[model samples]
Target: MDVVNLNQFCIIFPCYVMMILTILWIWRIVNWVWIRPLQVEKSLRAQGFNGNPYRLLHGDSRDMAAMIRDAQSRPIHLSQRNILPRVLPLHHHIIANYGKASFIWIGPEARVLIMDPLLIQEILNKNNVFKKPTPNPLAKYLVCGLSGYEDLKWAKHRKIINPAFYLEKLKNMVGDMSTSCSAMAKKWEDLFEGRMVIEIDVQPYLWELSCEIISKTAFGSRNEEGKKILKLQGEQAELTRQVLQSVYVPGWRYVPTRRNRRLKEINSQVCTLLRSIINQRQKAIELGHVKGDDLLGILLKSNEKEIEEDESNCGMSIDEVIEECKTFYFSGQESTSNLLSWTMFLLSVNKEWQDRAREEVFRVFGNDPLHFDGLNRLKTLTMIIYEVLRLYPPGVIFNRIIYEDTKLGHMTLPAGVHLLLPIILLHYDRELWGDDAHDFKPERFSQGIAKATNNQLAYFPFSWGPRTCIGNNFSLLEVKVTLATILRRFSFQLSASYTHAPAYVVTLQPQFGVQLMLTRL
Candidate 1:
């Protein structure tokens, strides 16, 4: 109890504390890189799966990054088997080496392939059983909506947002989409005035068109603001994609790094603009100047109804709604633009199909404005679109995480294992499709999606089941209208400068740009 004895005890206690802390840190690393992964590897091996053995700290991350860098460093040549290797270097390597049902580690967490049609269906169907994992911080900040929610929150959001993308609602917005396309076509016409045909890279134009269409259709009067968001989001998504592709280190965002600070600033800038747009929309709703028809109006109206119906089942916060708006702008614009770009590229390659599609479009509406009725009648055009989607899907893969021990097919998966459903692989699978699965065959889907894969869950460019892309109908209508409008005004073919490289950023886009030579019809 003496002071001198107390001082001695304090000095010794500090050293003991430091020793214990260091031991705990080392044990955590041991568990991550060795003990825990070994246990997971054992479980997967029992299920007849094989893959690269885990390495300390990085696991397969360094290998994946190196592969990606190597892939990017090469020339983007066309006509050979493309996309799969470039988009998902690690996955392609694992599948090629260890077979389809192989596992690879992203840090310590194992991602095992589930390539069977029925098993993939089961995983997607049970939304709650297989939860979506938290994406990189930049991804979450840039785009999160129903993709990020679970349980009650997901149910409520899905219910309210359902009407926004219904066939009926999407039909009403077809004009906005078509009108935007027409403007673009007119601009093209002007640009190629004296020339019989003009060669232009159409990706940037399609990107702008889609952005304008989504902004006008969703936010109505606030498209000017939406344009600002569109510019910022494009940059942010590129940055996020880079971050996700790298070997992710936890707490990297917290450090005062240059990229981190830039991302934070972009986030703040976007949030501020979005808030202004939202407030303006809210004021308009209060004034009864607009119906809850536009996406923003509809979402707010739907959320308000939920709150009125039950206070405990609260609607989304303003910030959550802002996030949803970001999701709408980015995904809606990205997918449709990619779809249109790829379809144009395909049509340019297959001039006979282009002639047939144009013939159909001309027969449906003889120099008239492209409308929903005319679009419905263009079955050939629809067939071409479906075929392009099969060959070049916007999303190469879809992932889900297991939060609890669950049975996928015949075996039980532990909570930490992630399910990897490579949709592009299935789309190109000869077993599901035909000998010409790798070839462009629109006739395959002339019989409709069900008959195309013999009632299989093989084609899901927009995904499938309960959590299907809510903007599916919207995107389709927009794409149909845009393609029809362009086809009517111009007869196009692949330009000599055109290169066929399907790149996978957030979406599968033409890496070298879709260059087409168009003549006024």
Candidate 2:
């Protein structure tokens, strides 16, 4: 009887332990899916915020996705300047129904859309209190360098990478940028094939031009390898886009799905290539076989200097350096290509602006090679670029998450609430930009950004304050060079086949590509 009782106790005790664990897990899930979200909703509603009531674990995700699909189904006219509705359908709808000061649900998370420039200024300035939200785990596989870092780590990477993008350092890269642009121009001319005018899709050419420029400037002599890395990154960007479009399940990235497997494979290949390049560059630098002049060289040199100063707590590891290189490729390529594409499209449609820009380009350079000083002197071109950025900014929205209860303006936001600073909405806000906000008026920026924004933090194409994009100046310079070079050779108009559809995939891009009829000057 004693032996039988002991055996029964062992089996029964194990069952009891399993039951307790299962109950705890279920309770945690219930709290996350129901209780916590309701509590957050209540807090937000009490604070005068209006949005759709929370519904289970999905929140407003289904509606948001539906709205986006509906919006993308129809193409807006080329003459339509109010692209806010098309680019961000759900946000536009929410703001229209719930007013500007409102909240929306992204999964169980409550993301409040703050369009007030003053509050945005505070959010951008107070980086410590309102921090960058954790990015989608899968995005890290594509590119996560300085942009993905937070607090002290961000500072360290920014400090080490600063010298690489300094005005002086970028000046050294101008020649490479000019050469790449000239190459693209030659390719276009060859495609003309003795024809006076040719209708070509400039989007692909612009992408290629941007990619080549980044490869050469970022990697110097190892540019061929850089090109290979960028090609892989482009694939990774597309895959990541697909993943982001779908509902993201926690731990889904680890599941060995076909897409997941491909992403990992591409990531592995990119890392292998970058690691090889970095190792080779380091070896060459140590042997004094190469002068560290390009962006990578400057970054490596800066990292070494940082380590020498504070050996224990400074400098980036090899993996971190590789990430930054990936960032250089992605940001440099994506931003410039999009800016140029839109500039071409806008210039094509608005012939007066195109002529004015071309006139300015001719006056500055006069059929001569582009120089840094001359590019800066192209004031009209600068105004046009600024306007394009205002209309079709690369990043439409900026996100921040608070880790603790924080006071923003008059309201105290609870911890875990996310903040969204919609750059596009503020840009198109009639209150800040007046009634003609949506119109493509390059003249608005002629008096400079401060004068245009009335000294408020209204216009931030590359964002504003302490955490502004590090590549702002670099991107502008590349755009100027490429645009000036192209403007010098050809006068372009939107081709009849061109469709005016701007889609937001990773960044704002011409959904059907920017096709133009190029007439040789």
Candidate 3:
């Protein structure tokens, strides 16, 4: 009788525990999807601001996704460069309905759109107050490096990495940039041999060109194995695109799903490859065989010098250094490729500006070797680059988080609220940019950025304040070399097969790919 009773007690206990666990899970979902977001929305609405009411579970994700789907379904004419409709459907819709200063729900967080230039500048300037929000765990696997780091760690990384992007250092990379761009161009020229004009989608080649430039500059090697490292890095970037589309749920990365497993595998592979390179370089340095002069070389050298001064003050670990290499590779490759693609598209449609740029390139480097000073002399090229950035910024949405309660503009934002400064909205504002905001006019930047937005904090394609893009100068120099080299050899126009669709992947890019008709000059 005693044994039978004991068995019954055990069975009943197990059943009760299962019931209780199920109840708890239901409660969690309710609180997370409904209760918490409703509370935040109430707090925001009480602050005298306006926006769409919070929706269950997905916030505005469903609506935003649907809107994007509908927008991208059609193709706009190439001459219509205003991509605000497709790239930023939700933001554009909200701004139109709820006014400029408004709010929206991205998951449980309230993303307030702060549009005032002064207010935006203040937020960007006060990094301590408006800290970068915690990134998704899976995102860390993609590319976090210096951008995601905060405060002290960020400072250390920036200090060590600064010399790599110094104007003098970047100038040393001009030959590499020219060579990489020309390699792709030569391929295109060969394809067009004995032909007057040939149509080709330019994105694929430009993507290769950007990757090759980084590989040449980053590793300073023409060897076979370094090419594999670059090839893997490029593949990793491609894989991350679909993963980026998902809203990050905590611990979802631990599920060992196919995508998650693949991402982890790729990340591990990249780190391993980078470590091999690092070890080889360290061995060479110890033997006094070479001075590290490439970006990776400079960073390692800088770190070594710091550690030598004080043993306690060590440099980055092998893991950290690998992350940095991935950072440079991803940022340099992604952003510059987009910049070049858009610049060429604009130049293709706006032949007047194309002529102006070609004329300037000829005047500055006409039959002479392209030099560092000559890049500075291409003022017309500078204007075009600035204009392209304004119209088509690679980073469309910049965000900040308030870790504690903070006062912004006319209201006090509660702790944990996220602030969004949409660059596309600001760039296309009529009040800031005058009546021709949507038009393709590089002249706005002719007298320079200060005169462009009437000296307001209105332009920040690379970003603003202390945390602006570290690779901006490096990227610009590459653009100068690639553009100057390509313009010297060929003239291009938009191919009839081309569809004008600017998309927001990890960065803004041509959705259907950029097709151009090339005429070998």
Candidate 4:
């Protein structure tokens, strides 16, 4: 009788365990789809934020995807105000349809779109509560290292990387920038002989110019593999574009689909290239024959100094160093090139501004090879670059994920909600820039940035405060040198084949490219 009772008890235990597993699975499903969103939505609504009603399963993901696809399919004409959706659709649409401070659902997540500049200042300034979101895993695979870190890791990385981009360091890179721009101008001059109208988009040349500058300025003489690096960087950028188009599916990267396979393949190639560069740099460091103060040398020196003083004070591991190198190559090359291309494009259309910029360049340098101090003296040219950056910023969309409950404007946001700060929308905002917000007027920046927006946070081409692009000084110096050198050498006009389609990839780029007719003056 005792044995039979024991057997019956063991059978009941198995049944009880199965029931518990089933309950947990159901709870996860319910919480993910309904419970959490409902709670967040209720809280946001309580704060007086009005937005589109959330759809049960889809939320706003479907609409967002459709909008992205539709935008990519059409040709972008810069003359039109509605070339692209106003940065954040929900925020722009909510303001248009509802009012200021409306909510939008972004895939089981509800976010309050804060349009007020004062509110923007508060969020950007308060660093602890609002931080960069956990990056998408796929973004990590494609381009890992810098933008992937959050919280303490981010703070540490930023701290270590800060010294490399200081004003003095940026001054050191101006010569390389001048050399690159000079080489590119020579190529255009050859095509410009006999006043022939060459139908060429200057975008590709600008990209090459920026890549060469990054290669030389970062690696010095070690930039021997720049061509190979450029190829890998281009592939990585294209893959990122493809990844953005498709909705992310978990573990989908491991799947055998053609797109996934191709993406993985690109990832493998970039990894191999970066690994090779890392190996070369390490060997150079071991040999104790450090080159000039290029970016790589500075970074390695900084790392070594920290480790030698106190191992615990070391900012990053060897792996992190390589990742930062890759980030610098990609980000530095992409942003600066996009800025130059757009600046040139804007200058092309506005001939009066172009001539004025040329006069400024000539006045500053006077046939002397471009130098760091000379670049700074070109105040008019500097204002023009700032104006172009304001009009066509490379990083149009800035996203920050909320890690804790935070106050934004009048709303109290919960954890797991992402705040979308649309830099593109803010830059063009009439309330922020007055009636001529859309106009490309460099005079707005003549009095310096503080007085530009009436001391508002309306203009942030390089972002604002803590998380602003670390390389802004480096980028500006490069642009000033490149523009100065190019303007002194050749005069250009818009090519007939040029189409003004400014669109967003990872950065805002000329979709069809910036076509310009060149003539050596």
lDDT of each: 0.84, 0.89, 0.84, 0.76
- Count the clashes in each prediction: 0, 0, 0, 0
Give every collision pair in model 4: none
Q: Which ten residues in a row have the lowest lDDT in candidate 4?
A: 82-91
Which one is best on TM-score?
Answer: 2
Residues 118-192 of candidate 2 have per-residue lDDT tens digits of 899999998888888887888779888998889999999999999998889889888999998999999888888
Name the lDDT value of residue 226 in candidate 4: 66
Q: Candidate 3: how many backbone clashes?
A: 0
In model 2, the runs with Cα more than 4 Å from the true position are 1-14, 221-223
Error of 4 at 159 (Å): 2.8
> Compared with the true structure, what per-residue lDDT tens digits does model 4 show for residues 1-521?
59999999899989999999999988977786789888888887787777777777567777766766666566655576443353334445666776766767766767566667787888788767677766555666555665767668877777677778877888767777777788888888787557655667788888888778888888764455665666676776777766654446457767787766666676677667767766677687788766647887778777777678776775688778877877888888889888999888888888899999899888877898878787778888888988888888988877777877876765668888878777777788887888988898999999999899888888888888777778888888888887887788767777767866666777888777888877677
lDDT of 3 at 140: 76
lDDT of 3: 0.84
lDDT of 3 by residue, 1-521 (tens): 59999999899999999999999998988877788778878888898667888877667766777777788787677556567888888899988898987898776678999889999999989887888887777767768888988998888888888988888898889888877777888899999869899999888788778878887788766335455655665666666655544566777989988878877887888788778887888788789887778888898998887788768877788888988988877788889988999999989999999988999999988978788988999999999999999998988989899977799877888888889999988999998998889988999888999999887999999989989999999899999998998898889998878888888767888888889999988
RMSD each, Å:
1.9, 1.8, 3.3, 2.4
